[model samples]
Target chain A: METPIEGIQWNSLGFSQTKTDFMVTSRFSTKIGRWEDLQVVQYGPVDVEPASAALNYGFSVFEGVKAFRSEDGSVQLFRPDMNAARFKQSAERMNMAAMDNELFIDAMCKVIAANSRFVPPCGEGALYLRPLLFASNCQLAAETEEFTFVVFASPTGNYFTSVDRGLRVLVTETYNRSAIDGVGFVKASGNYPATMLPKKLAIEKGFDDVLYTDSNESRFVEEASASNLFFVRDGKLYTPDTSRKTIHEGITRASLIYLARNELGMEVVDSEPLTVDMLKSAEEVFLSGTAIVIARVKSLTFENDADQEYKYPSYEVGKQLKEMLMDIQNGKRKAPSSWLIVDVPSLPVQDQ
Target chain B: MVQEGLYLESPREDLDWSSLRFSYTKCPSLVISDIDISDGADGAQWSAPRAIPHDPLKLEPSAGALNYGQTIFEGIKAFRHDDGSIHMFRIDENAKRLQRSAERILIPQVPEEIFVRAVKMCCVWNSSYVPPYDSGGALYLRPLVVATEPYLGVRSSKVFRLVVYATPVGPFFSKPEGLAVRLVTGFHRSYPNGVGSTKMGGNYAPCMQSMAEARQSGYDLVLYLDAKGRGLVEESTAANFFALVDGVLRTPSTHRKTILDGITCDSICYIARHVLGMKVVDDEDLPVELVRTAEQAFFTGTAVIVSPVKRIGHEADSEMAVICKSLDLAQELKVILTDIQFGRREAPEGWLTQVTPSDLEPLT
Candidate 1:
């Protein structure tokens, strides 16, 4: 029998941990030299060495994917293959072992089947899946060969509460998230704590969060604290070209850019870093992520010598793009060639 | 009185104790006052600590420490004296440093009393594993503070865990000729206004690539410079660097906000001023060229005590020094510190703390 999905207020849910019934875990030991202990276990703590490199050294990487209940009753995943591809690239940078796409996709499908009842209704929210890979050897030095890989799911709502009201952002000139030519491009865990100092300062100043600049010059706006940025100007959608620096290549941002240029027949520019003035004078400013989906920006508080305020006209373009993406995600419109995967069957009963 | 939860486990008697490396051993470590970092909950800083078996800790996949690198740690050692008594060197300093590291990452700070007591308990329980003073092995104690709150956001964790463990390891340098180091001009350890000073996990993890490069080319470790200039000598991958220019001893000042404040580095500077009667200057621009022109150079830390510099190599430039066994001041300082540590010589007022049986008792 399926898990009874009762007493759940899916519409009123916030971005929090709900402790679903199951989590998929796997491990790799240096002595054995192969992946072992792969199964769907209870959603609880597993054995970890207190001195593991993940605890003493910043030696871990993770990815985020979302599963949505489509217009049909079947549940589907949005760009899970992209997440797996990026996970492999990130692990290579951190000197960790890689899990091929087949295992990564198979694990996601199993979790969706096992927790098929927990998948929310078509319009409420999606199941957020987090996959974390780390160095699990207990040592002080950085030469760790053993590692652990795990995947867990949580029911989450809008990342920013104000979907309609938009948000205020602080442009931090003093602090940086990561140095270019460093691990900035990779979604390493250490990169998050490095931004808490600047984010705290932004919150204290009554702003939503911070916008980090390049580490050396501190002039060009690289990215937001947690998400990627996009701006619309002169009938063109533009984002920073992260070909060289340490900006995260967001999948949502990539999909929207593809739709705009290929289908909508609009010009999409992946050009230079979006300056503070470009964002101010743009038609619309927005943030994109697996969690933030697509949210419009209201104003920017440039915290340089003098705190100057820059405002955009409206969020018409942002609203349209969000609807376009959600239409395909909810299966209201026919998705492009290979965007959505909707073949997960409901799981059967098990002997607990 | 014996504590209720203290596990007085026997020591291991496996072969090849002489060939032990500085890594995790099978000895049981002590864990204390684990605080859970929860959402909207003001977690306690610490709880009653106890001795536990050395095994894997059960953790969720979304733990803040495992996901965001919200972890910090300290390293110290327990030395066995000539009379077979064991003590720790400046463990109080390690406790204070752990607090600074916790603040940097927003993890709960382990109380100094709890932190110091945990280290002592690990040493007391594993006393048999301490290498003999003549064999030159020391029982290395590792104190780790990690965040364990299960959340998916990129924020600081509210839950935390503290662990202290002991392992017996051979000395860093067993011969007279000291370590050979290469200057890594490509990679950078830390930048300005970064968490370089704090003993956080992020500071050490990024340097693994450079350390691997050094090992591939037959060098001990890599030497780093200011990431901007790639010229000014910062420090080695693990230890701090010092050069003897003129008659004064010089190390990179923490005011530069780049060098980590090694306790061993600080203690040796004290002996230089008060015991050796030499003028020490920590406030000097440490240029990479100083290694070539300076009279002598060395590295210092808790693991590698006063290691003399035998050679410094960059891409094409390599500087070698004469093996002056008699004129090396670093050796003299190491001997004085070791003598005091081994109970063969009287140390300064608050240098070492003897780990007694009563110190292992759990607090009521």
Candidate 2:
């Protein structure tokens, strides 16, 4: 029977260790090693050795995928296969064990089926799925042979903690997110921690997120710490593609390209050498991710700017594109059947 | 003329030790001795470790080495031979790797001769911990170098410290059969144009969090690939990888990023290719599938000389099991290597260097 989640208020949510219905998990042991113990389970704290490699060395990778509860009460995953692919890519990059795609897909289905109730109803919110992998050995010389993989889910309303009119991005020249030959491309923990110093600086300067430049030149636009950026000039969409140095391969950004070209008939260029001047010329600027399908950019502050400032024309939430993306995601419009999957089990029933 | 640097004091000789355990615990006895020097010799006895216990050296939180990861270390075991003679294995190689690491991290260089002397002095001072030959243990020596200069920028450290510490340890692996391996697909351990080739503490620090994640998910270790996501292979967090594919021994080359040039890895390559008459290729030109499908996949390092890789995981390919008789070959190699280090067997090309009590005739 399908689990019912009636009268559950999800607004004003925070990340806490609360009891949950299910999670996706996998294990690698010395005996069998690598690809083993792939499964989904009820949510809880996993027993980890203090000497595990991840804690001391930051040897872990993760991906954020969302399951949407469509209007017809069906749970749908958007480009989950791509997430699986990237998950494997990240694991390989970190030197951790790679998860089998079949097992990963099965685990995802099981966890989403078990927690379908937590997936906010269509048009409400998204069931945020975090698929994580890490090294777990106690040996500390330099290399470890132990590892683990897990996928957890949370029902979230918005990715950005605070939803204001729009957002202001401080262009950081002193700080870098990742080096060209570094772990920047992988969604590894180390990549995120490196941004802490810069992110903190941006927050103190009263900005929503930081627009990081290239580590070497500090001239070209890289990413906005978390999500891929999209700029619309004369109604044409443009985004930065993955280079040897940067890591923002946004699934939502990819989806927008399809939406703009196939549905709206707009020229959607995927890769470009996005510069501050190009960003300034853009009439519409937005961020895309699994959590925030699309968000408008209010202003940009460059260190080299006159009075140390440059602003975008759009300070308000992007109206048309947001509706189009969300409408398709919520099953309000007829999606090109390829976007939807079916025959999934019902979610666990929960109390309000 | 004296070289200018930090001042150090020796350990107080009057401390009582009858009741205290000698085992190295999590908390060390407050760095009882330290010293600063700017010069040393070249060959056998590089330099002595000056003892200093007071006014421990201080460093800026954002020191170039801390933020940019400018550090290097060498692990050499002091084996107490059956004849009661103390000896070291391939000290020259360790010193060279240390210099290479320092260069990569953009730190000051330590002459090879000076490095050997400091390690020798530290081992002699802590000689009580050197286990008996029959006791299945040896004195583990770690010579660390880190930037200590006061600076907030990301450039190389203008000043650094060379530290040596010794502790007795049993086998690196608790089990005799050696460890199992897990192949990864997601994380690249190191990359080209990155610091993967060096032995920087920064490189190790970034891997800790992921290592934790790997353990929780149920794997023993991780194997990172190259950035191209192609057939390019690299070393693990601490060790280098080697495999026997169709009777040929192969491992990733150091031409790309994402690998540490391990001493053991080099030894195995020499023995397998030249001594054992096996085909060997150091570069990543070989197919990754061939490496994974090999009868045996093993990692080499100073502590764990050879660990067998049991299984490999990938999103695309099916899981493959390793089928090498690793124990038999590994045991033989381990015996040969350990014997040479302990002076039980004839030195292979002058690999062992004896460090007698007479070497410390004039103790600092």
Candidate 3:
């Protein structure tokens, strides 16, 4: 077995980034018409034109995936193919060139393998991979002829570091996360910045995050700032309809739904529109995302009804689900073999 | 007199200015300013503005501008008068608009003084690129601000950089026949409480696919409606829409904060109301149906200036209506605006800031 890096305090890792050794990158241009071969380079600053479309017009898309160090010290990726497919969709929505799924998966595997030392030990943390595609050429107009794709890694523990009891959420009717026909369904870089202000306001009002309502009617619940939401009523799971095209179809949310129905034998209502009233009456509510694997919602405060608060008494379902999912992720239990990509080849550390 | 050698070499002599299109023709230098807030609250400071050679910018791979769209920009033009002096048109408005955009996305606002000074310095350093007055070209100035911090979280950056560059551009729409616009109802450019009003990078890229698809269908531009299905006119891809209805200039109100506050649209409205003695209805809700019966229609922005719309087609309704054939009003307004910009006509107070060699004396 290869020795892990010496300096990292993996036990105290938070969601913030810890610098790693190497990253993978590729470039595409109109003249080339295809992505160049992936190159492993030192993880550091990159040079881009000041007038590039990525900086000037927000022509960028990104994906998030995590590679885990299992119980036996073997590194494996969880559902990277899903992330690659979504990355292509996001790039297409942003009008930038998208690398094929095969190249996308290959680049992710190479970066994870190169930074294998940074992957935390089992039960501590995971090496988070961020794959970004952006327009790299300088243009005054809202278009670009050249593009760049980079896959970088950071070791992180958990999204919510201190939320052991559960999260307190605020249901906001004033702000909308995305429009009906907007880029909410895609992982465009622009969609996230707009939520920063709303999230800050929610935090100021003493809440963990804001639960956004639809922009058109403001009567239905959409999603939290960064993750997908699920409501458990009468032991049946209800979530927002991603087919509405205004909600991001989170990969973690999909896996949890699959686990709830197939593994736990629970009744799952995946496609129904969970309204504010339904959320208020839910017995248990939770959020799912790549960063926040699964977080229980203890209470929700609605801004519309004189600051009415709804409290949930149980976190049993969420706890069980998190355990089962993590068990699958850590290679503790038997499941579909295709869910985990094991046997990632590690490259020797190069001198910086 | 100021130093004459402070400027770069004169504009390229081999190129035909008349044949230039609305594209980037690199200038000699650009001005930059940076702000850092990483130390503490009181430790926030903006670096002294500096002019550097035109080159690519170095940034951390995880910059907020690249990962989360913390970027905003403004566009202004410098026109050369008959006497060979260059003057920028209404730069103060662009500066204020940029500040508003910055505040929306939580970026540290570039001080109005710094923005104006940097743009003037950038233009003065590249004054030779200000095309000849008779060539119908202008030095287009782009002022951009981006968040440069390397944090992985979705929050405002502790570091921000502002870069101002210049490029010579001809008319945005070279077609003398006028632009053919398609009324797009399928995709909404912006929503009721969204960031459409800001000149942020986020608002533009998402609309490009819609604009490109429109172009492929034999149209020059796409005119978007309100996202709420109110049948109200919003704006074009990157410009504000206007119609000459019943001898009054009508445009969508910006009160909803769903459309950009266009500088050229304001200038045109001022001309229509005060200079040309025409009633301007800028605060009213312009319905999409109004274009079908309007006398003339046009789009206004820093790029387009005032390009007349020849026809508007609605695919859902199966209607193709010609707004105007002669474009008399659009032509007249464009001429008046251009004359004021080039120092031929009397400009309103604070309408133009003439670029002189003295503006670059401090740098020298």
Candidate 4:
């Protein structure tokens, strides 16, 4: 396929949508229940209700995990079990049905098997996997009687950090990613729609992202609209715990918790109620997610409370943690036995 | 299938049109004084159900129901009496439920008398479609209220449409056995601070993914927990839950929100407390796990009056169990409720709304 935009560094850009290979699908009926006819159908437009629960009320949940191209010309998904577990959690959060872990794993395997070639060779672009579930009943009333789940794959280079642009995030009082009791922790579709306006305004203000504060008091840092936030100060790692009201606990964020502690011999504290002052005092800062595994934050712009600004010491992705995470993910460094799933069958694919 | 005692009259729009179909049926007769259009059109003509085409509705893309989710609906069934009389089971309750749904969803109030009249008129007009009482099939009534306004805004629609469609349904659960439900992890169907208790269109859309996943996972249904991820049990996809713990009947209580205070659920609570002499509990404070340990668990709705849960799966907390007692309790309630609905047993005062064919027959 032709490049989406000319004159751009192709390798630096994450696997563009033009390169997305295949998707796995299934149907549900009262008679047959859940039936899977796994195929690598080309990705295309889906009919969405304008007042769909997801569109109007944020009633969808999603998970992002990746398939890796191993050194032996075989494709393997990294801790798909974790993704399935998290997917179930997300599904439940959105009041959707939960996918049995075994079925979820099987579906992911089917996608990887169908698009084996797209699982980029080792050290290249990782295959991004997105599992989406949403309401599908035709009942015009608020009560839904049906639903749909799909797993789509995209071959991408990397996320956010590849741009090498410093992030100028504005902390705004006007917008909050999620209010208390909202579907913030889950990857609900409505959550993203709510963030679009504030995010657009922040981008127009020359910021890469916006850091959302608590919807109630606008006090502590919650998360970026898309990714979870992480900070390091005085050689100690600090990240928001999942217990707080709203935030998507990204898989990469959890992985880093282990990487920072065991692998790097650093004391990693995953849950700390952070504020703008916390960012100002931070020695290092970064964000984590499946798309952008880890991206460093250079500065924080507080639009609320007097528009104050704070900059971190380092603008580059932390070499120690990044290398450590990448090493384990790419099979360069040995992962704790519990973290690796080496025995799983790898689908036949291109050279790794 | 013919009911000899049901009655019908000319549609009157002066009263609140209960749903989309009812609103359509009364459009032509919508006393022009009742016309409340402000958007400045020709103030379009209204037509009866027979005169209107049965194709997909002609509505603006950005209409209220499509944008702000300004819609409410009720599910009811018309039963054929043994004496060839047609009756609606707990229609007044259905009206009250619709009213509550409207109030919660911020839609205009629908009067009880108009709602009953519209349903009776439709039943009379389609009397031939009512299945035989012994056939175990009844006509399912779906009364929907949607916003018809063309403007794109977050507020309620100025132009509202109410409609009712009838379908013959045999049984919601054809399976001889009970359903298996998995207790969801950290997901509440509705939240205490959110729109969980309302039967709004937006509420159901979000749950489609979860229901699809559950059915995919070899489960029949899902029982979502509250927002805190604790074991605070909410309702299933479309039904309310009740438990027979020890000898006391228990159900989740609704405050501002949490679970839809289902009409059937309320009826069951009434029967159990007043008639069966059973202790009833509606404390929304009880954790869901406590109910799971109850002697029996059952679900209630308009279609499947009461059904039982056989299994509960807690994927996150590594908990999964099957409660045989719940199945037994569900069967017990099903028999009682079915007997009352089918007219084999006596119902509480002001419950069943009897209809005569002559009452619904069009006057020459």
Question: Chain B TM-score for each model?
Answer: 0.91, 0.80, 0.95, 0.83
Model 1 agreement with the true structure over A47-144: per-residue lDDT tens digits: 77877888878888899888888766677888788888999988877777788887888778777777766777777787888888899887755378
TM-score of each: 0.91, 0.54, 0.96, 0.53
Q: Where does candidate 4 stray beyond 4 Å?
A: A1-352, B1-53, B315-322, B356-364
Candidate achieving the largest lDDT: 3
Tell me the spans in candidate 3 whose CA falls farther than 4 Å from its real position. Answer: A159-161, A337-342, A347-352, B1-10, B40-43, B320-322, B360-364
Classify candidate 2 by CAPRI docking class. incorrect
Candidate ranking (TM-score, best to worst): 3, 1, 2, 4
Listing candidates in order, what is each one's chain A TM-score?
A: 0.94, 0.89, 0.95, 0.87
Give the candidates in order of DockQ, highest first.
Answer: 3, 1, 4, 2
lDDT of 1: 0.76
True contacts kept of 4: 0.04
Among all windows of ten consecutive residues in candidate 4 chain A, which has the lowest summed lDDT? A1-10
* TM-score for candidate 2: 0.54
Which lDDT tens digits does candidate 3 get at residues A25-104?
99999888999988988999888888788988889889899888788898878888889889988888878898787898
TM-score of chain A of 1: 0.94
DockQ of 3: 0.73
Positional deviation of B82 in candidate 1, in angstroms? 1.7
Docking class of 1: medium
Interface RMSD, per-candidate values to 1 decimal: 1.7, 11.1, 1.2, 9.1
Which residue pairs collide in model 3, if any? Answer: none
